[model samples]
Target: MDYYAPESLSEALDILGRGGVTPLSGGTDFYPALTPGGPRQSLLDITRIAALHGISRQAGGWRIGAATTWSEIARAELPPAFDGLRAAAREVGARQIQNVGTVGGNICNASPAADGVPPLLTLDAEVEIAAAGGTRRMALSGFVTGVRQVALKPGEMVVALHLPDPPETAVGAFRKLGSRAYLVISIAMVAMVLRRDGAGRVDHARIAVGACSPVAQRLGALETALIGARPEEVRVTMANLGALQPIDDVRGSAAYRLDAVREVIARMLREAGDG
Candidate 1:
């Protein structure tokens, strides 16, 4: 196998445009996917590219580089509204994986159980992609097409993720129901952001469920139901998550995942209310 570590974003895109080059960020997902006879030939390492290596505040919100690791996100002192992301970051894997698994890699991998997607979707995040000619930004929800599938073009590479400013009254939480406590793929996961009025009624709510669908989806119906609802009322709204399409997989059955969604949503709402 051959390796090329680009020092700039343009160089990386140029390599991608040539085709047959696997773009590597942190290599957490790529290395594992490659076995004795796997389809990996050449690696285009982008971690050395300075333009794709940090988090910064941008025009509309924040821009997180593709190479930023989960460990970096977990350690950052973000606003309370980003608590859900921090929590998900901490649960991505053991300490070692967190230190090496980049947020871009997680999104690019496009797994149904990806821990980062739920929180990013709840934040209304956008993904920035660059190819040989230009760049484009697409909503995270639209960027992911299905399980292990994304809308990125053949020559395009995810450069950064943009997140809008969070509401001041916002409080967020995340919950994952897996078979084991640590280092396990989630059977179901929930990421929620709630903004309450001064009178304690929910002014705005964003809820997303993962590992239960083709792609992690925001519970728009549930979010709408929670509007103007009190904390106790929020729990009641969570009981109706059966509308989501969950599949029976090796990790869990469809019925169990549906039930787990409800339970995780309730737990997230309860935690958000406590803070």
Candidate 2:
């Protein structure tokens, strides 16, 4: 099979239009999932593309290039509003994996346990897509359709994630529960972004959970309920998780995952609301 390392996006897009290759970013997922010489699909190694790597300021918030590694994200000089994401970044894997795993790869892989999704969802991130045609954007929520699935069409790839400015009053927190303390797949995870009013009540809340559903989802009901709630009083019930459907897996049972996330929310609410 052919292998390519294009340094420019234009060259990569040209290669994509030819249609017989798979784009490989970071390879944390791609290399592991590769079949042993079966199919022999061409490989487009996009890690060298300069345009696809870095984080920059946008008009209102930030744009994180798709190839940006978890290490870079963890080290980025971001505000407190992004603390949850940075915390999640550090937990993507061990230090070595964090250095190699791309945020774009995590998103495109669409793993139900991906640690990056919930935090980014809390940030209200949108993905930028590049194709032979042009560039377009989609909400992070709409981009991941299911387990190991995404909205990419043939000849298209994720370019960057655009995060809108978080509320000035917002503070964020993240928590992950795994079979082991570190370097293990998630049993459950939570991310919270909360903005407090001057009266010490919740003005806004965005909560997301992973590993408890086919895709991580923001808790709209919980967010709505937290409005006007004092930080210590933010509460969650099973009703808040009606949208999620966790399965019984090696890490934990469906019931266990639900209970774990409920406790995660209860804990994160106090931490995140302190901002």
Judging by lDDT against the true structure, name the best candidate.
2
Clashes of 1: 0
Q: Which 10 consecutive residues of model 2 have the lowest summed lDDT?
A: 266-275
TM-score per prediction, in order, is: 0.95, 0.97
**Residues 80-173, candidate 2, lDDT per residue (tens digit)?**
8899999999998899889989999999999999999999999999999999889999999999999999999988999999999999968888
lDDT of each: 0.87, 0.90
Tell me how far the alpha carbon of residue 119 in candidate 2 is from the true structure, in angstroms, after superposition.
0.4
Provide the lDDT at 33 for model 1. Answer: 76
lDDT of 1 by residue, 1-275 (tens): 78999898988999899998888888877777777976658889998988887889877688889999999999987878899999999999899999989999999999999999999988999999999999999999999998889998899999999999988878878888888878999999998888999888888888888998889989887888889987555654434574478889889999888877887677666665665
lDDT of 1: 0.87
> In TM-score terms, which candidate is top?
2
- Candidate 2 structure lDDT: 0.90
Backbone clash count, each prediction separately: 0, 0
Which regions of candidate 1 deviate over 4 angstroms? 235-239
- After TM-score superposition, the amount by which residue 72's alpha carbon in candidate 2 deviates from its true location, in angstroms, is 0.3
Error of 1 at 138 (Å): 0.4
